[model samples]
Target: MEDLFYFKLFLAFTVGSTMVTLATVAAERLGSRIGGLIGGIPSAVAISLFFIGYTETPQLASEATSTIPLTMGLNGLFLVIYVGLARWGAWIAMAGALFFWVALAFLVILLNFNNFLFSLLFFILSLAGSYLILEKGYHLPSTEKILMPYTPLQILSRAFFSGSIISGAVYLSRVGGPIWGGIMAPFPTIYISTLIIMAKSKGVEFSRRITKPLLVSGMVNVVVYSTAVRYFYVLFGLALGTVLALGISAASTYGIYWFLKKRMS
Candidate 1:
């Protein structure tokens, strides 16, 4: 039943993107700048974080993850630091997914998770993501997007936001693992993008939409960190938690992106 719910959530997002794409196409035909911008690429930061949040949310929220809360905290923190320094937004968003996948593969090699179930869950998720990228090309406006290089504000904003989200996700996932840790990673980013678009249409430029999510999201992670440290003695510890966490996040991320890239091409 729970797995079914997840599938439904994925389906909803898939349908939502389709509707948005259709609207974008209509807007393109109407020849309005706002419509055209609607069809444009979301900031790379948005896309990356969206993926992270989607993957991690269930882990952090579920009863299964509760059994290893300490593992989740340590695992999340270890992974966050690794991704925080990455040069690109895509890398950070994809890290947990990539790590999830790699870790899963090795787990199978060592016979940890049930092989059949792992393969089934992975294939379904991968297909959904691939279908999304294939169905809609971001079609960024050359004039506006190309100006990213010259926009001091945009460059700085992207760097700071991307780094903060990845670092926070990493740490929180330590307390939450894939369920909580993975899901928490992307909320602020998603919230920011949704608002930026709505505000752009209305011509509002308040930084609050972006900054507030950052603060709230970071606070949530800080809570997880404090909770983890308090119960640190209880986590019993996984032998190679960090490596495994990285492997887990990295593999899933790579598989989905590769599938999307190939399908779109």
Candidate 2:
């Protein structure tokens, strides 16, 4: 049993890293809007939820899954903060945002509603509110095209950072209860890492432009995916559940992306 656990952990790290690396590369090659859409895919979240379901009881996994959308909604706030303050420079904006994330995470955990229905309600409200707050006065920058080159080392580093975060979240899910696990699941690992790289290479404005679409797409993707995973993981098994959930998430993200592009354009 212990050996199986370790193997699944290893697999999560490997696959999660690959997916994030690919997403990062896609973001660079495609440009900010497309990159944000790809980054919003919830690759790491899917892997974490799958392994959680695989290693723990279905009930626990379902409980954990319920919190994901709420946490992701919080992540949208994090992006809003970071992008809103990007003029302060990447390090300061990120530092301030991280502080807010931690404080808000603790507050949510303390609230501890733990009811799936309430979580879904909170997720919807928070996502909509955050999107409105972010988009209220902000104007999308004119389309700018630039490609930032990454060396092999940088690519590897990005993958490593993302995989490490996913692995840590999995470990936390075991140590912490479902609520804590759910809170940690959407920690913005990929967003922070990718944003830092983009800020350094492409400039802060370029990176900031990516966050609006990322926030919109990510919230839609995770809410749909996590809700599906919560139900399907129990109704079906982990494998089929994950597949069906991911398919739903992909469709939702694509639709949201299309809507956002049209709205912004």
Candidate maximizing TM-score: 2
Predicted candidate 1 versus true structure: per-residue lDDT over 141-255, tens digit per residue: 1112111111344334434554455445444444534433333333334334333443344323221222222222222232232223223312422223322333433343444
> Best lDDT goes to which candidate?
2
What's the true lDDT of residue 245 in model 2? 92
Looking at candidate 1, the ten consecutive residues that score lowest on lDDT are: 140-149
Q: Give lDDT: candidate 2, residue 188.
A: 83
The digit string of per-residue lDDT tens for model 2 on 69-164 reads 767767878888897788899999999899998998898888874777777777788777766766675664533333557777888997898787
The lDDT of model 1 is 0.34
lDDT (CA) for every model shown?
0.34, 0.78
lDDT of 2 at 225: 84
Clashing pairs in 2: none
Clashes of each: 34, 0
> Where does the lowest 10-residue lDDT sum fall in candidate 2?
137-146
In angstroms, the error of model 2 at 93 is 0.7
Error of 2 at 235 (Å): 0.4
